[model samples]
Target: MVTIEPIMIKGHFFTAVTVCLPKTTLLTISNNTGYIMCGALDVGLLNSRLVDRKIIAGRAVGVKTIDELLMAPLESVTYEAEQHGIFSGMTGVEALLQMVG
Candidate 1:
């Protein structure tokens, strides 16, 4: 079993440092606002969700993961306008880490 700890440091961009114990793995994920991306995303999964170019930010820094972010606690941010939480359990992202790192 894996434990999930979602943390939020900024809002302009959503950043999370996911730590997996027992396995002793760590991932630093930075994604745009609702416009998000990560270093731990899946190419195939992202390709499957090919949306619009305008919707996807060009400043994607990390790898693309099929895993969706686990929603960070509302207390993590002040953006009430956003419906989708910034951070959450990213099953896909975590799996990618397991495979890659």
Candidate 2:
């Protein structure tokens, strides 16, 4: 399980990980004002250490940086290809906003 410590990146905000899902799938919310990852790491508990996390499911690989996790050419995975399951058809800036929540 990849447990991300509760950190206030850049000191501007904190992530309230309400649900730790096994898969980062998607479902829309607030009429598209915001979106949520269906299954992800649980990080939204109070007074909790990040070490207390479990792994439900994931690929054999992981990367912490966008650059390190270079994907295939943009042409390979169409914008639509990545939208349905994991991101609800969103990526780039849109996807970043979801994570920043």
The candidate maximizing TM-score is 1
Model 1 lDDT per residue over 14-50, tens place: 4455555473343434444233334333333333454
Cα-based TM-score, every candidate: 0.26, 0.19
Model 1 scores worst on lDDT over the 10 consecutive residues at 72-81
Q: Give stretches of model 1 more than 4 Å off.
A: 1-13, 24-28, 31-40, 49-101
Displacement of the residue 40 alpha carbon in candidate 1, Å:
4.1
Q: Give the C-alpha miss distance for residue 20 in model 1, angstroms.
A: 1.3
Error of 2 at 99 (Å): 8.5
Position 2, candidate 1: lDDT: 34
Best by lDDT: 1
Summed over model 2, clashes come to: 4
TM-score of 1: 0.26
